[model samples]
Target: MGLGLATGMEFYTFDSVNLVLTDLTGTLGVSADEASWILTVYSCALFLGVPISIWMAGHFGYKRFLLGTVVAFAATSIGCSLAPDLDIMLFWRALQGLAAAGLVMWWRASVYLLMPKPQRSPSLMRISTMLYLSSAAGLLASGYITDHANWRLIFLPNLLYAAGALWLIARHFPNQPKPSAERLVSADWPGIVLLAIALIALQVILNRGEIDDWFGSAHLRILGFVGAGALILFIAWQMSAANRTPLLWLELMRDRNVLSSALLGVLTGMILSGSVFVLPEFLRNVASKTYSATQTGQIMCVYALTAAAIRPLMVGFIARVGQRKAIAFALVMLIMSMLIFNRLLTTGTPGWYFALPLVLYAFCLSPLLPAVGSGTVARIDQNKLLDGVSLYMTFRQFGASLGVALLTILISHRETLHSARLFDHVRHDNDVTRTWLSTVSGTLTTHGGYTPLEAQQASVRMLAEQGAHQAAAYAYADAFAFMAVVGIVALCLLPIVPPTPVQKK
Candidate 1:
């Protein structure tokens, strides 16, 4: 039940942003660009705060920490719902991110603490199933609320989940005695500060760079430099620091299996995050006929269902063929999904056309997520497991943010390029352009009883709209092609990851 609440709340918070962002812009009188910071700030705060939270949880017992964070998370969700301006919302969202980081860390921590090492894989599989279900259901539920009720009610699911989480923790988990003040104060404050600077600055640059014209904007250039320098300093400080409470437990990387799994974690994040970001935007804004939020959500639920169905087979396949081979097969499915999209995406493509690729993508996700996560900490020292998991998740979150930003930039640049090239071919002197314009003008004159001048103007406007649609379609196709190539490269890397050693049941 604790796991259920955690899974539900995670999906609710993340999916809430995508499902209602368009409505949010109108309700708050903010541009879409401004609205994007809601998710960006949440992710940035989570990435920077997770390692610190993991370090501190040892001082403050997991049960207390989990309950406090859940309550705080619920409170911030309410605050976000009530926020009247962008600044207020952003402030609340940052706090929400901090609380969410703690909740997720404690969620995994609880799993590790309560169960024996051998029992963990099965437990993880169950938790992964919950995650997939919540992801499938959360978006549809939020979209329904946004359409029929209020956008604010989109967060109601988090409140429900948090209430249940609080009840379960309070009832079942015992609170340990608090550590001494000295123990709390012993954390490496300098390392924490430097790490925060690096993570937050990098996220800000990625989230806002395209809108600000990339490096052309002085602000982004400054952020890029700060992020780079701070990242270098943070790494140096962690490696050489004599502090007993270092920000990251660098020793976790000594285990080759954990290191390889961490890399796989990053790719898994990129795949899932990029899909969540792109599919909704493409359906909502760029489809030949725009789809309603609820419709898009329902379609995406297909991906979730596919994942859930295939999960039972994944563990057996891993056991039979080994983790390395399992991951390789999943990557092939992923590449197939992306290639299908590359060939099929177009303005004229039907809504149903997305189902096949989405299912294949889901097939990739179901196996790889559990495989990488279990393989990552399978051989780690029990005392260092928390740090290892925290670091793994932090990398995954960073990859998620990076993938979304990169794909957004790619589509925007490609759209502009395609639009310009298309324009050159559709000029007034072109015979095809002359014939199309004449046909459109004649139709307008006959049907709408418009004058020649008005008909010609309307005809030109329609042609321009169609051309823009075609350009966007081409851009999306190119983006899909790029992702397919990335998947293939990821598959090629599988040969280097060592297989999990045999274990007795």
Candidate 2:
């Protein structure tokens, strides 16, 4: 557990570097959409690597695998920090994703192997809490760093964290064989290749959709076919490999509970990540705060206190009220919270209004984190725990990816349409408006120390910026509308939450 907590510190490095992919267009020469490959590529690598990594862990000792992964993960971070170009940086990011694939699979398996059944949940919570805290820290801190200093500094801390994790595992963890108490899975290279192709191609298309203008662009058109073909091939491969070492364990996804859990995980990710993506921009531009200040403000919310304040209460609720009811109640809080936020948003609103909704939202989100995960993965066949955990983790990661892509696409489209509509009837001959803008421009120039033309340009820039934000406000509201729909849909699936857990074998 200490090792888990120690290894989790790398999660903190995000506070330092989280916005690199988002802001890289301004920082690098790539197009806004092209820069997103950095994110999608990593996800693809992780999806491809998970199964293979799990299989290898069985042959090698547990500590040995964890230590190697830590080293590889850290080394890639160093490469990412020093990357001279976008393409190079993306390569390093993908490598990190591949190497960082199964840290948790091994950790969970080891815990169950080493510890008693009754002791497992608490130990798992310790690790989960560490991750939750680290993530909160990373997002807020990384926001401040990106605003004030350099983005590369974010990657530096991960190096240290990985080193510490390596030292801990090397010194304390025992070198033990993979338990044969459960059934052993056979390898399926053909299915693995097909699945990798499907994920990579599909992720590429989704990641590039917004920037490439979706199907309108030639790049997306080609990738769409590539993705479609891969899916077809993967489906065929799975059909034929049902009893063999299939790329996907064909029977696992067929389980009603497992399918619902995966979908629920996806939905959970979609909302959580959309908020993360939109919040910083909203605070910095719409809320009239500096980048660093915007980030600092979020830390004061209930998100920072979730593991400490929320989790214990949730555990109690589940123990007393029951899991399904607790989850349902939490979902209610989430929807109500979002509604509160949507209602309060206007041209100008106070910070307290934001806080009220955020607290409610985080409170609702808290229980689902543990409840959803524990419910989804715990009941699976013990031997296949590695695969089950890997799938769940992949689903969770993919949710964030989907959220970022969808939010970005929607935000850009809405902003453009609204900004265009705002000045549709404007004329250069409107003296009052022109005079006001000219005066505003002149005053800005004199106060800001620019030439007349330069001041006018600056004023124009400001106008465009304001217009963009106005557009974002609308997009954000719509995004929440979509989120509410998602929440409703997920809630409707409440029947998926069984009265008791799946019977563990």
Candidate 3:
């Protein structure tokens, strides 16, 4: 189950890192800022989805749930591949998220059910190891697909994989339907809708904020009100009901570890998701690195190597030193890598430059999350574990959305500011500036056969483009710095409390 699921999930993090948005914006001609909603919408869908999915899984048999999820997931990938417009793309993305969350929740429940306590240790290791390798493979493959083939080709392979998986499960895995009495129809629909509304509205505001110049544009302004209203209503709805199926049961908040993990997952996922979103695009497009299939694979391959190498060692370490300590170290590595990222980021920096720190960060991160997750979910009541994992994963999903949106926003904002600053120095103010501009203009005119005057204006536009690239690079650096601080604060805020001096969990 672990191997099958891990292989299926191998591509989970790629959409985040490979930055399908860059292709969507640059190739598909979507607006630069609007493109981020591709990620934002997917994540927000997952934010409120995992819990509902878990309940349905419990109500239905696990095998049935898994099979159904993959079917939906496969179909949606096909739809996403053929989507013609941004709005249509968003709808497919949401469906994909829904299907994905269901698949993952069922896969995890299956793993826990199949493996005994002792076996779970090594089984978990195998799953983690496979996930790292497959994720690296997917990232590299996606990049190559983007470069050589159409982006849609990437999903073709997924469709084949999912179909095969679904077929095997249907044939081999028999489902034993549970008693209807055990599965009550007690879900809180109002809370669910409000939460979804809140998340969707907020995503719209963030993703479109940069392109619309924050609130200066009316879309963002109205979105702000909608997001705020939804959030307020969501809180009221959750608190007002003395219900059995609160979107997130308030009783679960009694556990500190669960609450901490839920919050931490959001931030940690943000850093991971956002970095993956921006860094690769910056490498390939901005720095002009030649990322042929092998080379692009190698960049992610390095990070995977580090994750593979460190995660196993931390497996034992997590058992011994505990999750809180491991999370702290992971945060330190994140900070160190972000510092390296902040200082070394430049338009001229090569692909190989980010290798060492990237590896370390990957290593620290690979095991840190599973460990923290185990600790957090361990706090939940035994019966409510499905709910616990759902909540944990949900926040992590939202964090990814917010992270991408914020990073995109930061890149947009800083580019404008820096470009404005540099334009002053480059404008046609003096002989040197005018000659420099005209020379660039002359080259364009000669190459494309434009008039001398037309080329001059084109040259100015070209200069502005370069200025924006440089500004974006600087902004990327600053964003990494802020991400590092968030890591540090998260690490320190939650102490690795003694585990009641108990034996291994």
Candidate 4:
């Protein structure tokens, strides 16, 4: 219960800000682009904070660290609510993200440390269900709150969630021996610093790359060089003999099960997060059925609920059929779902056309984390379980960031190409174009009380608008096609994942 509340709260906090961006822009008197930094900074801080949280949990014990982070999360929530300006809000949001990282990491670590082997898979699925529901609820709740009340009120719910988590954890969590001061002093500060530098640069690039025109921007180019250098140096330092206790256990990647699980984490994360980012934008701006924020949130709730409902069944199937076969099936489902999305997401398609693909995608997502997580935990050394989980999670985060960046670039590039091709046929020289424009202009002049010249101009403007929408529709379809390709790649790699151990009958 404690883990569920804490995890849900963290997920909710991460997502709730999505609906409130417009409100913040207006109330805080910041531009839309500037207001986006509120989210970007939080994401960067959250990723950077993950490694730091692992180290802290090791030193301070998970229970104490969890409680401290909960309190910090609550405090930061209050700070965010009361923030007077954009700068203040961004500062508080960054701290909130750091607190959230600790909360998420420690809660999962607690499960791994405390749960019996038989119970871990089900427990993880339940928590994952809560995560999906909470994030979905965040979208709906924030939209409602933004509609009915001040945007600041969105952070208030965290206090209630934090209080419940703190009470439950404090009363029931197992106690652990305190670490000695020597352990703290021997911490890998150099590795920590390098990791921080690398993550910050990488996250900033992921979050801002589309806006900044990616490699074309001199700023991103320098960041790319710096991030790559730091990552390389960090790897070299970790593998060196002088470093007794590394921040991350690089050697753990040698285990085939661990490596495969981590790789699966990357692939699934890309599909899940990338689709979430893309689908809403498509519905709002590209699809024929332009949905309001509330309507889009409702549609997303269906996806989340379907995944939550099917998660346990999928986990049970994985246990019966084994991870390799189960994952192969899921990948096939993913490919089919992506293709379905590509086919259905057209400029004239109705919103209901997405339900089938969403359900299929949900089925594809439901089994992945639990199967991979359980397989990883079953295979890794008990003493190094936390390290294994942290590594897997970090890979997942990186994959999600990469997915969003790549998909964004793909959509933009494809839209430009599609728009160019479409507009090329709209010239006055083309018979089809001339006839269509003349018919529309004639109708406007006859019934709409427009002058001949005005009707012609309006007809051309309408055609341009329609063409733009069609281009966007084509671009989104191409995005899903790209995802289908990714799914195929995942399917091809399934052979690399070792079979789960046979149970004694």
Q: Which ten residues in a row are the worst by lDDT in model 1?
A: 176-185
lDDT of 3 at 504: 70
- Greater lDDT among 2 and 4 belongs to 4
TM-score to true structure, per model? 0.94, 0.85, 0.87, 0.90
Better model by lDDT, 2 or 3? 3
Residue ranges of candidate 2 with Cα displaced over 4 Å:
19-25, 29-32, 112-114, 140-149, 179-186, 211-213, 216-219, 239-243, 284-287, 293-302, 341-353, 425-462, 501-505
Q: By summed lDDT, which 10 consecutive residues of candidate 4 come out lowest?
A: 177-186
- Give per-residue CA lDDT, model 3, range 88-174, as digits (tens): 888998888787777655555555555565566566676677667666656767767767877766676666667667667787665
Candidate topping TM-score: 1
lDDT of 1 at 99: 85
Candidate 4 TM-score to native: 0.90
The candidate with the higher TM-score, 1 or 3, is 1
Error of 3 at 241 (Å): 5.5
Lowest summed-lDDT stretch of 10 residues in model 3? 176-185
Off by over 4 Å in 3: 10-13, 16-20, 167-185, 211-226, 239-241, 288-297, 427-462, 496-505
- Report, for every candidate in turn, its global Cα lDDT versus the true structure: 0.78, 0.65, 0.69, 0.79
- Candidate ranking under lDDT, highest first, comes to 4, 1, 3, 2
Off by over 4 Å in 1: 174-185, 211-213, 502-505
